[model samples]
Target: MTAPLTDDEVGKTVVDAEGKELGIVAKVNGSRAYVDPNPSLTEQFMASLGWEGDDEEDYIVTEDMLESVGEEIVLRGEI
Candidate 1:
C-alpha cells in the first residue's frame, strides 16, 4: 500500500489517476482527509451529472485512495 499523505498537505490540489481535479485538501485527520470538494455549478448540476457518490457527505481523502504527494495530492485510481 502507498504511504498516506501528511496533514500538512492541506490546501493542496487533489487529482485522480486520469488527472481529473477532485478538490482541495480541507483538513487531514488521522487516516482521513476532509476535502473542499470541487465546485459544482449548482446543486442540480451536480445531481444531473452525478459528479460522485454523495454531495452532502463530507469527503475524506484516505491513504488508500492516495497515490502520491507532491505540490498537489495525486489519487490512486482513474476518474
Candidate 2:
C-alpha cells in the first residue's frame, strides 16, 4: 500500500541513515518526490563561472527510502 504523505514531509530536509544531507524535498507529486540531487563538481564549477543553464537532473525517492516520514525523511541508507 502507498504510505500517507505527512504534512511536514514535503519541503523538509532529507537525510541518510548516518545523517548525511542528501537533498531537499522539492515537491511531492502523488507518491513521488522530485529531489534535485546535489550538484556535481562540474556543475558547481560551471555555476560559479556564471552559467545559468537549467540542470534538469534529479532523483526520485520512493517509499523504499523512508525509514521515517516525520521532521525529516530519514532514509534507509544512501539511495
Candidate 3:
C-alpha cells in the first residue's frame, strides 16, 4: 500500500488527473486540505481560479481527494 503524506508535504502543488496545474495545497485542516487555486495570484486579482475567499480564507479539500505528495501534490479531481 502507499504511505500516507505528512504535514510537511501538505503544501505542495495539487495537479489534476492529466497532470494539469490545478492548485497548490495551502493547509491541512482536520481531514481536509485547503487548496489555493493559484498560489502566485494575489488576492486583489479576483481571478476565478483561486479559492472562494480572501487570502486569509481556506479552501477545504477532503483527504480522500489527495492523490500523492512529492515535489508537488496531486489530487483525484479538478480543484
Best by TM-score: 1
Give per-residue lDDT, candidate 2, residue 64.
65
- Point out where model 2 deviates above 4 Å: 1-3, 6-8, 38-55
**Which tens-of-lDDT digit does each residue in 1-79 have in candidate 2?**
3366543354566788998888666556566665546755664454345342333676778876677777677778645
**Candidate 3: which stretches are off by over 4 Å?**
1-5, 41-58, 77-79
lDDT leader: 1
Error of 3 at 61 (Å): 1.7
CA shift of 31, model 2, Å: 1.4
TM-score of each: 0.66, 0.62, 0.58
Candidate 1 clashing pairs, residues 3+ apart or interchain: none
lDDT of each: 0.65, 0.62, 0.58
Provide the lDDT at 19 for model 3. Answer: 94
Tens digit of per-residue lDDT, candidate 1, span 7-28: 5666667788888887766556
True lDDT of residue 29, candidate 1: 72
Compose the digit string of candidate 3's lDDT tens values, residues 1-79: 1235445544467677689976766655456666677565553233233333325644666767766667876677543
Give lDDT: candidate 3, residue 58.
47
